[model samples]
Target: MASTSGSTRPSALIGWRVLALVYDLWPVVAMWMVASLVFTVGYTLSGHASRENIAPFSALQWGLWLVCWLITGAYALLSWRRGGQTLGMRPWRLKVVAADGVSAPGLRALMLRFAVGTASLLLAGSGFWWAWVDRERLTWHDRASGTRMVRLAKR
Candidate 1:
């Protein structure tokens, strides 16, 4: 990991970072809903349509889970890889970038961000709160993925 000590890059504050996440959730949810519909149809077609079998699902449920996971991950990945800004990040003037704070992140880095970020969120946002006390003010996803959410200068 590169030490960003004394770097002049402006990292987004936690509040702005969170709000951008909130903004991004809309599309993620929308995409997940679509993925869920497909999963439901697939499950039904797989001869598991019976009501009694639906509640206590088999390990095959992981298929649906993975599909939804990929749907959301693709959203974050493409946005960061293409322009470094998701729709949510734009209004807030936020951009997701590599540790260098300039280069756009590649697929591997973006995937790490999504996986670690989801884990962070699932942990009652402890990873996010870590920034409050971190010397560099970086969240777990940021540090783990070597990516940063930077605050852009006003246009």
Candidate 2:
């Protein structure tokens, strides 16, 4: 029988994964800012937006947040689907694949990963930190989305 304990899995260390996340966040943040600006501009044109309407529960504020989230998710999902890795992950030789450790994850899985991953970040990064104590070293995002982050051997 094939071993399923992740014994043969070449997972990267949490430290390296953290570093890769840091690197990836640079571009993600830039895109978020641009997206936010565009959303704000468009909303303002709708006549329901205001320069001073920064209230937490304001429709415009919520709209901007949702748009930014979607924009970020699209970037992450497309990147993962295209090559199984992102810009930061490329340097670290890390790849996200299906939880079964066989094929690439599908679009639905990628979307789940992105959504859950964002929640994990918002919750004080407890999700990423979960890898340190997880038996298989899988983060909450990976577990939630049924995905895995594997380390590629240096070629």
Candidate 3:
């Protein structure tokens, strides 16, 4: 008979998972919001995009969207490459680890993960939904990156 004494499941509670989600997502939202405000207000103040030339608003929107994507990608890549925790995630005591349990993620893997994350959110939350059913509770990005989030080990 197979012994199951030491083996344990890797999962977290719905509430902790929610907390983890909030903790991991808020920074990305905040960055986008702040960038939007800066771009809109600055362009309006500069008169480059005023009531008379509101066409610039459309351009500004697309530019800021691209900027947000770059910023998010850089953040995810750097965090995973450095400490396995994004700014928001660290506060919540969560860290991303590879399936093999390594602390750092590769650059290509980070890019792929972030890209899948973008696509997932673009289609309504299916990427995040993967976390709900995955045995290891991995988001689509996590699956792509071959990583999983876990509570930080005690010091």
Candidate 4:
């Protein structure tokens, strides 16, 4: 266990991280639905028939996807910045902090963490798996962003 702020806590393992992500997915999906709805309404108002779905692979469809991604990123960045943990992480007692294990990381580091985490997911979670073998049990994003996730002690 690592000590931080005069308390002993373990670095969050892969299992905890995966569980938190699964929980977080619910809210992200909800955000995606709202973004899709907005895009659909805009598409209809822009001369497309109300009955028509955005054509697959169309530029508009791609833009909608990008918007969804940005919205999800905003949700994560804001949550992490405002508090060390997101809703998902709260149940699991996971908190993100600087590598030194106390201070909140800056926005740049958090953005790096989010981007690298996205890539990790896109790569089928190889970056996350790396934590299993890491000496410090840190994921790629944790290393890249100079941040770490710790499992807080029970209250």
| Number of the predicted model whose lDDT against the real structure is largest | 4
lDDT of 4 by residue, 23-121 (tens): 999999998998888888899999989998778899998898799889988989999999988889999899999988888999999999999999999
Each candidate: RMSD? 3.9, 3.8, 4.4, 2.0
Clash list (residue pairs), candidate 1: none
lDDT of each: 0.81, 0.82, 0.69, 0.89
For model 3, residues 1-155, the per-residue Cα lDDT tens digits are 10122235553333454575577677888888888778778888886745544464687667887999897788778887888777766665666666665456677777887798789888887887777777666778878877666665445
Candidate 3: Cα lDDT at 49: 42
Give the Cα error of residue 124 in candidate 3, in Å: 1.9
Candidate 3 residue pairs in clash (backbone atoms < 3 Å): none
Using TM-score, give the best candidate's number: 4
| lDDT sort, best first | 4, 2, 1, 3
Tens-place lDDT per residue, model 2, 91-144, is 988888897776899999898899899899999999999988888888998998
Stretches of candidate 2 exceeding 4 Å from the true structure? 1-10, 43-53
Clashes of each: 0, 0, 0, 0
RMSD from true fold, candidate 2:
3.8
Please estimate how well model 3 matches the true structure, expressed as its whole-model Cα lDDT.
0.69
Q: Give the distance in Å from residue 23's predicted Cα in candidate 1 to where it truly belongs.
A: 1.1
TM-score against truth, every candidate:
0.83, 0.82, 0.72, 0.93
